[model samples]
Target: MDTQLIRRRMARYVEMVDAGDIDGILGLYADDAVIEDPVGTPALVGLQAIARFYREGLGRTEASAQLTGPVRVAGNGCAAMPMRVDLMWNGEPCSLHVIDVMEFDDKGRIRSMKAYWGELNVERRPE
Candidate 1:
């Protein structure tokens, strides 16, 4: 797999998220893709589940993510993209430092995406 291509794809993914294009975002995933946001939540598998997850997750507020650093890729089709998330979670504005580890399939679509974040990564956004 071309690492540069994957990096570019991830960059586009972030852009899609920031743009609130749910369908466009889901297009990057393989049919059987799995997402484990924050790594502990039950994984959302398949397009339907993934779509539902993002619809509620992204629809909740004015959410946007900006890349904080380089996209790191491994030889085995895995990449780590660090980003800063600004959103209004449950009517409360907040910021979070996040890293999404995406594992791509041979077709170059994301097969798995696991987000790493924690309570300490959460911060209040000024009113």
Candidate 2:
């Protein structure tokens, strides 16, 4: 698997996610892909589980994320990127800094994705 190709694919995936295109976002993952979110439960496996997780975890919120820097590719088609998520949660504005790591399978589909971030803090707006 080519690391550069994985990086490009991941960039597109992020774009689709930011656009709230769940189907497009899921297209980047393999059938048995897994996701591990820092604030969520243990590994979410398989496409169905991943889809449910995304819909319930992220789709339920009005949030957007942007990659803060260039992606770094490591061995075995693994890539990492720093990201910032800004959004309104529970009627409060929140911002989070996180690092996302993705591992691609031989077929160039994402096999695993892991996010590392601090606990989210929601702040009420002053009017």
All candidates: TM-score: 0.95, 0.87
lDDT of 2: 0.82
lDDT of 1 at 23: 92
Q: lDDT per residue, candidate 1, 1-127, as tens digits?
A: 8898799889999998889889999999999999999899999999999999999888666789889999999988999999988998657789989999999998889999999999988898998
Best by lDDT: 1
- The residue pairs found clashing in candidate 1 are none
Query: What lDDT does candidate 2 reach at residue 6?
Result: 81
Task: Give residue 3's error in model 2 in angstroms.
Answer: 2.1
- After superposing all C-alphas onto the true structure, candidate 2 shows an RMSD in angstroms of 2.3
lDDT of 2 by residue, 17-78 (tens): 67878888889999999899873659989999999988886788877778889999987689
Supply candidate 2's per-residue lDDT for 66: 85
